[model samples]
Target: MSKEPLYSLRMRAAQGGAHEEGGLHISGGERLGFRDEIEALVSGLLRKALQHSRGDADFINLTIEKVEPASCRVLSPLPVSTYEVADAEEGRRQAAVLLRELSVSEQAIRNALCLLGSVNNLRGAVLLDSRSGERLDTRGERGIRVSRMDWDRERYLYWQNQHPLFGSPRIAEAIALATKVAYAPGTVAELCWSDDPEYVTGYVGSRRSGYCRITRLKEQGDFSGGRVFFVEPGTFISEYIVHLERTPVWIG
Candidate 1:
């Protein structure tokens, strides 16, 4: 019997003329066992991406790649400051403090946390108007999706040069995305909690504050996860997205 090829799927979608930076570019292959599973997963992902894109996406493309497992490079977790909390309530309290320290408005923090707590593991994030505390995501319940940082050549090259030091592909991508978006015009701050079932360490970040990991954002095994980006009141949504998809960032 032949061994199954390692299958991975990559996506790039954009509205109007953003091309490769269409604000949704992500890839996953990891432990997939069969080609059929890849097809099913990719189909579902594209559908979700389309819905979240609000019909402005001019195009969406899926790329399938097969590789040998031996070609992959494994690495340890990236070193970041961790704030341990005794329980979910404590975690929520600490998260509020961190977000406030980043100058995230009180109302915005309250709404963001509420959304995260109430929703299931969302594959995307919520965009909030910090000053008004209004939800800005186009899809409402579906939220808005952000990615494409791993596609930026400058950023990817930098990440590569750093090697096994940058951590898992998922976390590394998150950090890169957060750092780039932090500097984008009109952005205030970003928050994230992982959906990996047992993971409880989430982060609150801004251009000035950097990334701070907080444990117990939810109870272990709870599985709910999401992200939020708080922006200024008058920020143009399209322009803000343009920056997030097109700008290249370098981490020193």
Candidate 2:
């Protein structure tokens, strides 16, 4: 008998009437042997999307993809702090300290955290001008989508040799994107909190600081989360985006 394929689901919704284009409103997960559970999962997600969109979503998109497990490589867990916090508030304080250490300005860090807390979900990272602490629109409400970046077997193996935190494909992908953004010219730093309700650990990173993980960055069960990339003044957003989308980067 053939083994069950892994399933990935993503659902997003747009609010009705006049609304800002980039607030997340996205829900998704990956599973194994969930064929019989798809219908129920979709129904639950639809309810969430509409509710998060404020009861009247102008449109919603749901996508499901199945792939063999052998086709993907699992990566190692990321390097996390030795200390842990029991609650979100404590997590926030720790995160603040970490971001500050990375040289992220207080104002920019505050703005970034506010955006993540308010958005129902963000499909991509928001770009912020580090100096003024304001959002930088690269391509309208769509934010910077960090996808299409997967490491090949050889490259992945090479990374494994360099660092012990080179497991878990999902974590690796997140780090890869973080590294790309952090190293991009004019980028100051990055802040990210996941939208997964159960995930409370988030991270702050920069070319100088490397990646630092903080647990309890968000309230448990809080679905609002996203990423922010802080950039320097006079940054050529267009070129930065071109590099972000086209460049291949690896983390050690």
TM-score of each: 0.63, 0.65
lDDT agreement with native, every candidate: 0.62, 0.64
- For this target, which candidate reaches the highest TM-score against the unseen true structure? 2
- List runs of model 2 lying over 4 Å from the truth: 1-83, 138-141, 158-166, 250-252
RMSD for all candidates, in order, please: 11.1, 8.1
TM-score of 2: 0.65
Candidate 1 residue 162 Cα shift, in angstroms, is 9.1
Per-residue lDDT tens digits for candidate 1, residues 1-252, read 124555545564555544433342222211222465676757765764565412335566666666454433222223356787898789889888988887788999999888888765354668899867798758553455553333233445665676555455556666666666676788888888865556677888777777677767888666467788999889898878755543333333
Each candidate: how many clashes? 1, 8
| Residue range 1-252, candidate 2, lDDT tens digits | 234544545556664422255433443322222467668767766776665423456668767666444543333323433337888778777777877776668888889888888876466678888877888875444567653233434656877677665475446656766666766788888888887676777788777766777767898678778788888879998888766654433232
Give candidate 1 regions above 4 Å deviation. Answer: 1-79, 151-166, 246-252
Error of 1 at 28 (Å): 6.6
